[model samples]
Target: MRIGLAPEVSAALRTDPGMLREVNEDAALAEYPSYLVADGMGGHEAGDEASRAAIEAFASVIRPGEVSTVRDVGIALEAAREAVGRVAANRVRGAGCTLTGAVLVQHEDQVCWLVLNVGDSRVYLHRGAELHQVTIDHSLRDEMIAGGAHLDALPGRNVITRALGSADTTADSWLLPVEDGSRLLICSDGLTTEVEDQELRAALTMGGQPEAVVEELVQRANEAGGHDNITVVVVDVLSGGAAWHVGVDSASGSLAESANEEDLTITATVPRRAR
Candidate 1:
């Protein structure tokens, strides 16, 4: 990211309403241990309320600048689901939201990224010229694609199968070790639908600060016809990294100290089962 190597400056976050939308219904956070984006769906008021409520839950459980545990995130996730459910309960149309992000947590006494996703918002691992999406979309079109149907044959892409405020609040997750110089992108659909992955790849590979890259992404999306609210967060695994890995080498200060996060450290999480 563009932030200096002060360790605490590990990420950059940005959000815009886009050219067509009057009110932005997206929310994001770049707090240490957690970086996420929420795409609120429904009317402007309901959508915005749902997204903000979801983010507030994280802010309540995962203290800023502290390392988080799986239990902490789990609690926050449940709270978020409940908050969104309340929003949906009141709205006639039923409010809901898509949430996707990564949490730095202690699993098995090691630092690991707990990547999670619900609905269609995404988390992508941007390495060099390639952009690898790490989250499985819980949308109708994506479900069809997963079922071996062609993209062109699928229905509208916005019909999400799962979301907060829905019957199922389960979120899919994976545990990943921190890789030095690793760059991750947590964004809403505004960015993906408007700007092609090829364009995103070029911007991510071009060595610039996260701020610049985020601006460019939003700019491209707007230029391409911003159909929805856009939110982007760039999280850098290591600022002044040296083969950083979040496991045994962390005690030697090889990879763990790169983030310089001492408040809450991650433990090992194998088998990838995080409720």
Candidate 2:
């Protein structure tokens, strides 16, 4: 089935190794219509490899005019899982990463946001002055809370129960109507762990440009101690078909591509933190 052309979009991505880490085990992409953040687990370079592999897998499938249905996204995510599993096979136990992002899709002639998540990474929507988290965390603490356990009684609150390379690698998906002028934020747990929801809401709502907003969020996370590698991607929709730009930062170099009021085809190597 042919999908409708994606809405005019623009995005910005930023990642940092943070104050406590030598290597950033995080990966991000800001290809219009597809934006994601992967936070890797495991130790040293192994986590970095897993996260990069996962992002590359998704990048391979998120082409313009491709990726129409939920099944299409699932296939891409499964490929990512297998890629991470391959890395895990050669490393010590627990090589994995959290994957969360949103892809723009057309359903019944209506544009929709297809959000996916596995682990604690998240996708949040900023509509007008309100910020709403679109994806739920697949963490032990969240599950316990869902099962009627009190938040105060939870243990291992940061332990993610689902992720790429895990035995259960299925990602939860949500399809929601796309609203004009709405903004989407996909980020690693680093930002959420460091900043409160109210702060995130404030930053998102106080946006001047997408790039500036992303920069502010990353800076705030670092100021909050920079305990872990942080990555953030901000996507904004323009009602009148605005210009589009895709920027990719990788070990080799950074590349910026632009499209004037048309669909953007993003092709680049995923960026990994410098060692």
Candidate 3:
């Protein structure tokens, strides 16, 4: 598929010094299409470091000129988790982070996108006129809702139950088929917590380019309070042609477009899935 990507990452207000609202990280395999996002947790500077560390660990494998696979992606994530755990174990006094990511792997005659996560970060698929959040939140509110809680009661009730570098280390991953023209939106809690799903649906349904979608999503988050670091990555699968799998590269550049603009990091790859 022709996958076009756009991403953004922002810090919170001037309140918490050096404390980003969210940390944005992604991985695009060299032989397969993959994407990732990590939201960190630690006090101020420590939290930012933890998130950046996880991203660096994952990026090491999917960086330009590296050959990677579905298995490689998983291994890379595991390494990232382990590395973060070790760092938090030695460096900080109770430091952790949440990690969420997605990868497009080829399966038989179809391409499937896998969602991997350990916290409240999310993966949403925009199909037709509706947007479906494929990943479940590992939080108390989500659990209560799953166990039958009122929709209105969900506000301020759902709190993260699992996160990377946190007390929990296990990450739940889901596999979804990648159809032609499917659009995948992955973001940190900063964006989702503030922006309403209906508004999110409207923005994604606008069918704008990936760049424009990121802009709108950021704006929505800021309007919602910008209480935390906001990060978003939008990937649109343009075609089903297998020929698009060859020739992939990681483009490095600053993502900030304005004071509210976020820091965006993108790594693109197309590799064969290893059995």
Candidate 4:
């Protein structure tokens, strides 16, 4: 991926406890260079505290208008791990939360989106009229599927293998080149479970600002049962980085279905068959 100029970004965040949950266990931080969402797990408000703590760690590392470095992001993530661990210490069952989001970072003289995730929460990129899941899930079902097991064969889908307060604190990170018109959607599992990728693409495809887009997506998840806490963070790059569209075969103008998450380069390939 080619790196370009520093990015000028705008972001919006929305979260709800959902229809069933009495307390919202989700927290987010969206201020220019930093954008993220955390989904807390555990009982008696510990989860909520864990999520908030994680977001606070990130918020402390980032300055609202100033550009941040990749090292700063690392510092923030490590801080979050420590903060969440403290929250978990107070709980008998162990409290934890899934952290996922994108941040603007200057790396090796290039500016890009440093997307990160610790659990099943996702970061999706929208560009060239195509939607790509930038972050992979750290959940049991997803891990099994990636290892060649069938998704339907998995006994349960909610068993996440990684989280802030869990044994695993390291998060997977990705560098996505910032296209001028590209948008990033950071969300918790609640939204992904209810809203299909196609539906999400459609909603994001509609014309509107970042705030309007995020609000509509949260509303969509609620309409679709809203079994858990829902959170959405939308980051738009009005201008930044090397400008390039994704998934369009130069030979044909048609959009390509398969996108590469295995590597940073988002290439067009064969369609992925659902298992």
Candidate 5:
């Protein structure tokens, strides 16, 4: 399987102030097929730190070139949750972050994409000319949708119901299967709020390199408003690949890290699956 990644900053902002990172912790035989997007919690600065810290903790565990299984993915995520909790524990303030990530584990004759998120960041699959949002948003908009709010009414709504650092114990995750020529997308709320899924599908399905898709997504966000930080990660599975081999392991000290906790102001933007 082949993978690609792209990260961009706001058009007006000189730098991509948003704190976002992606890494392949540990896997063997094949390159780690995983992607992550962390939307910081603090205002401009603090939120950036929360996201960076969480990403670092998660990345340190599973380095590249190590074999990973579905069980390994779970253990790795648990380690990440612990790391975030430790950060909050040390500091008196409730310092936390939103983490959305996905790991590609080889399955029998196919690939299983494991998705884990603690906020509104999203994961999408573009297959057979259809762009489907795999993960649901854990925000007020979702709640409203469930409560009978029309899609057209929730404009620029910003309230995240769940996040990684907000609490210490649990987080949300999902698993998916991908076929050859399938494209997987993981992004922060910035991109989704600015550009709808239909637009995203249209751009990605145009048939270009990952970089092109990233560029188009960014452009669309800017055209829409570019209100908040925008981050996008794209992964495409190529042909001539087989199922990935995975081994089971216990989740103990698999992930380790430290940081102080502080309530980062979320002066920015902030979800489920089928069986």
Candidate 6:
């Protein structure tokens, strides 16, 4: 089978611990066709460890220059769950993390996106002038809403009902057809917690480059009372012609250290497979 993203696919990413937090428990990956974000939860170092472990598991299994199948993605996530479970076993508080992202794959000789999510982290699609959320949140608030609970009555709306490192690590996935010029965004609740959906859509459709758009989004979240760790990955689908090359720019800082004064941005581009 042909491997690698179509010549048109390119992406940019950014992450921040937020204004109020001392440590950033969020981790993200922006490899072409494999964009992901993980939000760690627990206390102290456990949360950071959980998030790192989950992303590491996927990194180990997904090669840099290969196309991954749905089965491959599933196995990688299972490994991540096991790794997180190991982290939980070592901590009295029991660590966990949210996993959400998308991978590009070849389906019936056409390139399609396979989106996955566990917890409230989200995947959004911006096509033409419209924006769409691609994943359902696995949070108690969503459950209540589904059960006819009023939005005003749900005070614990942020409490997630599912995550990695627990017994239930079943991730919901969707395979979507590719549309040229479409943009995909994968982000943590940090960005969503502070920014409204309309705001996100406006930022995404503003016609800015992926790098600028992500930086602006993070900046906006911080300006809106940066209450949680924020992370964003933006993927741009272009028309065929550009060569495939991966560029990743990640900031170096520890969760234990004070939040970096500068935003941590990572960008990567994967070229299309040669015929």
Highest-scoring model, lDDT: 4
By TM-score, is 2 or 4 better? Answer: 4
**Which predicted model would earn the best TM-score?**
4
Q: In terms of TM-score, how similar is model 2 to the real structure?
A: 0.82
Model 5 lDDT tens row, 1-275: 43322111111111132233332111111125557777765432245556667776666666654334555555566666666666666666655667776665543333455566677777776665666666667788888887998878874446777776674334554445445566767777778777877788788789377767777787777778776677777777665432322311111222222122322111111111111
Give the Å shift of residue 122 in candidate 2. Answer: 0.5
Across 28-134, the per-residue lDDT of candidate 4 in tens digits comes to 98887888999997453489999999999879877778667666777788788889988889887888999998887776567766777889898888775578787
Number of clashes found in candidate 6: 2
Per-prediction TM-score = 0.83, 0.82, 0.71, 0.86, 0.70, 0.83
Q: In every candidate, how many clashes are there?
A: 17, 0, 18, 0, 17, 2
Give the C-alpha miss distance for residue 116 in model 4, angstroms: 0.8
Better of 2 and 6 by lDDT: 6
In model 2, which runs have C-alpha deviations exceeding 4 angstroms?
A: 1-5, 42-45, 64-68, 240-275
lDDT of each: 0.75, 0.74, 0.59, 0.77, 0.57, 0.75
Residue clash pairs of candidate 6: 244-271, 245-271
Which parts of model 3 have CA positions greater than 4 angstroms off? 1-32, 42-45, 63-68, 149-158, 241-275
lDDT winner, 2 or 4: 4
What lDDT does model 2 reach? 0.74
Task: Assess candidate 6 and give its lDDT.
Answer: 0.75
- List, residue by residue over 1-275, the lDDT tens digit for candidate 1: 12222233378898999998898889998988789999997453489989999999867888778667666777777778889988888988888888889987665555667777888988877655556777777888978887899766999878888888776656776666566677888899999988877787788889488888888888989999998899999987654333543332122111232222221222232321111
